[model samples]
Target: METNLADLPVRIFHVLSRELGRDNLWVKIVDFDQDPIFSMKQLEIDNFLKRDNCCDQVLRRWGNRGQTVGDLLRRLQLLSRTYENEFDSIQLQLRRKFKILRWVPDSEEQVTMAVDEETIKLECKAQGFPCPTIKWYTNDSKEPVHTGRSYTVLRCKCSTEHQYKCVATNEIPEGFSFSEHYKRPGKLWNSVLESDFVDITSLVRDDELCESCKNFEMGRLSQILADDEKVENKTIPVPSNLDSTLRAADKVALIMSNCSYVHLPELMTPHCDAQTLADALQKMNYKTVTLADLTLDEMRYFIREYKKLIGDGVYAVFYFVGHGFEVNGQCYLLGVDAPADAHQPQHSLSMDWLLSIFRDKQPALNLFLLDVCRKFIPYDAIGAFVEYSEQFKKFHRAHRNMVYGYSTSGGVGAYEVKGEINGVFMKYLKNHVSMEISVMSMLHGVLKDIENDPKQIH
Candidate 1:
């Protein structure tokens, strides 16, 4: 087929791109129909050739699947901790509340304490890693008079009777009603306000509900507080929310990550991340299975059999952490047996293959939390491997309500916290996910926390 551009003497060249494969070709006006007769105008052949070279360079860079050199470089930069734009912080715990203890000092009682020049030190004992911040509230004021270390020092000018209360608060995740069970969700941020420290003396006295219900809530509150303390020590058991999930018939999640690669250095945080996330999942009453340092075949076998554990009434979650790469646009997960160099495709499991298994199962929501990043993949021709937004989006579309979230967006390396046991994203996730919400809501909460990282460089 040809188009006649109004009586002009033009010749079209059938330019075939070898890089684009034999099935695809392009038509170019190489040198027009340069007839010796009629004193034809000279074709801009030099500029045309230069333009073609530029187009070829782009095609080489993007390929058929839109890969780039920067993709691989970003992975290496992250692994080596050499990103110029990346920020460093000794502080890992960003904005999130810790478990506030109902200590005697945290009582909401009205006490008239006499003030003088002798420094009155009110100590607030709370269970948090950095220790709970103690702020003194006088006369029920919203603003605190002091917030420093363990004691809020007050230099009284004269002998005055003052009603002072010590408020102990760590950053509680917004939208979670861990603070107050009765307070409604916030209109702006949707965060649940912190509940007042329980005064066991008064709470047991005012019996509003039947003995059973009150005991349950008190048990649940005790469990929540227990989790708060355990989280600080990095040892979380089946929490209060899990029992509620079991009662509600929540779905099960199978979480696993193999960071101890045979060819790579043992990662300091992936296993910790997997375990912490697993604990959170279990607290949400998910029959979660977390594994570390599995071989390629073992990973495949476990995923293959994972479908049998699911039922139609529940959802499934699969969380992966470790090195990830793509070969020819298909994503793959590396096990501990994965080689540093490309030897055989069997050494790494194709992520698409695992998702295929997930889609085959009967579940309402298939949630996959991928902590994997595109690393230096050794393909025969395609020099690099990296995750793409398109692949995840396509998977998202493959099923109805197949919710998934990554630690970082595609083509970026997830950061690591130096002293913290979990990676950057999981650290926030472990702090934010609540059993009170749906799986998607839990993940959305996690994503919100990650987006709010103060030190994040865009």
Candidate 2:
């Protein structure tokens, strides 16, 4: 006669007895409820005697089941009301934290802080989302008293040294703060400037004649040669030492791509895309150059040479595509041959170096396109990931005549499609330019189209 018993509990008990040993029954009983195979309340004395602590023993007793009890439990928990509530709360918090307000600088009404003989004149119009409050404080005081709306003019009567702090606070639910600091005239100069100049000159030059003496002589010569018209509008031609020459043109485009080695197969794509863009600009009667074909040294030489060639009323377009790394809130673009090793400083190029070149020249419309996202590496790599900088955004806000476009938003990777006519971005750009689309329209259209496409890797 066969005894009637549930198959799962019976088999589990048998395996448990064998694995734990019949003498060790108390151990099994104590841990039985904790075993994931059995529910907390389901482990009774009989079932406790069956199962083992070992994974193999328990798995065998479960008999090759399609879904484990643990999996079902997880699925059920996910579908439960408590889990759903927690998820909703988390999403709400995320939304609140990331909500950014539209902020426009009050450029129309200038904020002028002028230091005359004694007093300092402060003029500013307060305008921001949820309007800002202005507070003025002196270095001597810890508390800042509110200054009336119109202006705050601080007089320096007895105090030869004073520091003014202007604090602008936002009236949001959680206060946001911004402050500007200014020192009294002639105070810092005597303490900091003279020593700094002397130190810097000493460090820069070790000649027998002191730099101070040389500067005095140069100052005398400058005074003797000074004519208002001649000194104010003096022009220096680009150095002729370099082999490169910048031709005169209505418009110029400087392309710098650092991902040449990693994206070697994708070369034709950028080349065609750049040419198409050039064609569009040419139709509008502007000259262009794709700097990807030139070496880093050559590119630098050509840029310096071009400043002399194109004096004024000239437009410029600069494009960069590559892997970039950010350290201490400054972004560095990787060259084609930049080493993957973190310790090699010589391999990277600073973004500021590139920007400084154009800024020195002061082009009418300096358009920049950066396609460099963080480099991709195997997931198992041990190095810590570095964060990108706010400088990218700050650059856009600080400069008036400049426009910048990035392949992807911050902290996101920009992707290149395989088997497409070009990299996804380049392909779209080429098509738009070939159709004679305006620069602004092309950029807007591309971004919009990317939003709708499911395959967009970015």
Best-matching candidate per lDDT: 1
After superposition, candidate 2 runs with Cα above 4 Å error:
1-248, 257-268, 293-295, 306-310, 325-331, 342-345, 374-397, 431-441
- Clash totals, every prediction: 10, 5
TM-score of 2: 0.38
What is the per-residue lDDT of model 1 for residues 144-249, given as tens digits with 9 covering 90 to 100? Answer: 7666433433332111124455565544333532324323374221221122322212112111113343244334433432332222244333335443222212
What is the alpha-carbon lDDT of model 2 when measured against the actual structure? 0.43
Q: What does candidate 2's lDDT look like per residue over 113-164, in tens digits?
A: 5554324455434433223445555566678644533344333222223444
Task: State which candidate has the highest TM-score.
Answer: 1
My TM-score estimates for the predictions, one after another, are 0.41, 0.38
Pairs of residues clashing in candidate 1: 96-171, 97-170, 97-171, 97-172, 174-191, 175-191, 175-192, 179-194, 179-195, 180-195
